[model samples]
Target: MSDPAPRIVRRETHSPRSTAAVIVALCLAVVIAWVATEGVLSLLGLPALLLSPRGMLTSVAGAPDASAASVIAVAVAAGLVGVVLLAIALLPGRRARRPLHAEHAIVVADDTMLASALARTAARTAAVSADAVSVSLGRRTATVRIVPVSGTRVDRDAVRGAVTEEFTRAAPTRPARVSVLVSPAGKVGS
Candidate 1:
């Protein structure tokens, strides 16, 4: 056996400093922008709010002489309406984000659909078959994984199209990512 060179681990070699700097700068920029915006808005609103309290109301008649009972009644009514609307908005959003009982999420999706779709698309493009397909559901997102069935060819474009077509019809919302795992051919167990 021949001697092999020692493997050098360079974690940052695969990534660039420019990309890291850009991402950091982007996050810092967003934070600074939000802070500046909030500061400016608060400063501008303070004068109108404190210097001229009467200006806060549309009508001068309702400012000083409004009875406490009327104010309480209005506050209660407003709170009730707000709570109802908030519940209506939040419940549906939460429900939509989660599968209706985890077991029922992928009723129609199966190993056959994914395998056949990838195989058919591969055959049409003269590409190699994908070994297996796995589907995952997340918060308002679904992901489909395609692993190469053989070493012949992995047509990423065709795979993406096939995966999108299948998910578009079945999933409730758009998928977040589709990853194609390239491995040695005939490794179906993997």
Candidate 2:
């Protein structure tokens, strides 16, 4: 029998600069401390090379410090770290956002004349705007009201139509209740 194909998976990638910088910062701290374990003087020598201007830092004229070997190694590591951090900084990261949703509910009654009522109710329920309130239907027996933006208007008849339409649209086996409420013009008095 043949082996099954390998599945491909998607992976997210992010800029390494922030991560690289953090890693380098940690490594640099360790390197400094490690040099001191050997001797304080070596620690002083390595920093000058690591931080100095370009040409002047090549290698000390003539013979190098016995500790120069470790200094060179540390410099290379720091350079590599710096590169990684910069690359990470340039990379993009992912952000998530959610879409807006309107409220919904179920309005219930006998299915006997639901189909007709739903069709007649289409226009009244179809218009939706920021000013317009959202409407829907599900099981039955429900009443809810909410603010429809000021310029936005809610038609009682249309609300009824929307619920009816949604209910009708459901398959015969999937009938649902309906109600479309437009909350008070401003606020519902306590």
Candidate 3:
């Protein structure tokens, strides 16, 4: 009997590559179109709407005669822009995403949902109201903020344990360190 084919799992997080590339492509297209329009107008012996290609070349050729400070500033600006684009192209852009491992398939959960779940788990474990707990999940850490009710003490260690357990149950590929923060000021009446 033939063995089953291996399944390929796609674990890519959100990246700005497509958006950046599209924006750069559109900008280049606009410049090329403008130059083509100017060339065609010159050929037809019509009045140029803007500077002609020859005029642009002449200005560029005479740019060295301009003030040294202005030329240096322009060159530095262009170099900085080039470096930024190169960094964007080479660096891997990663976003915060929660993925739950399942037997049959992986379920992707929204960041807000993950945060809410962690908050709820911590609140329930700490014997507090839902509104008393808040969670913020980052790339490598999940911070659980708790505002205790007046005259009540919240166990930070307990809350941290519960939140950590719940997060571990989710089984994300990239695990985050769970941290519980108890507010110094307690809320009134709740």
Write down the TM-score of every candidate. 0.29, 0.25, 0.87
lDDT of 2 by residue, 1-190 (tens): 6432211100111222455568778988998765444454444554443334322344544336638787788789979977876656775542121111123522233333443345334434534432333333223432324355455556766666556445545434343455555655643322
**Clash numbers, per candidate:** 3, 14, 0
Off by over 4 Å in 1: 1-131, 172-177, 184-190
lDDT of 1 by residue, 97-179 (tens): 21111232323233345445544544344344333545554443445454545445556666666655654545434354554
Report the Cα RMSD per candidate. Answer: 18.0, 17.3, 3.1
Top model by lDDT, which number? 3
- Model 1 score (lDDT): 0.48
Alpha-carbon shift of residue 145 in model 2 (angstroms): 4.5
Query: What tens-digit string does per-residue lDDT give for candidate 3 at 41-132?
Result: 98998878799878989989999898999999999999998999999999867666656777776576777888999999999987889999
Ranking by lDDT: 3, 1, 2
Give the poorly placed runs of model 2, Cα more than 4 Å off.
Answer: 1-126, 130-138, 141-146, 186-190
Clashing pairs in 1: 130-149, 131-148, 131-149
- Model 1: residue 30 alpha-carbon error in angstroms: 49
Candidate 2 residue-wise lDDT at 41: 41
Comparing 1 and 2 on TM-score, the stronger one: 1
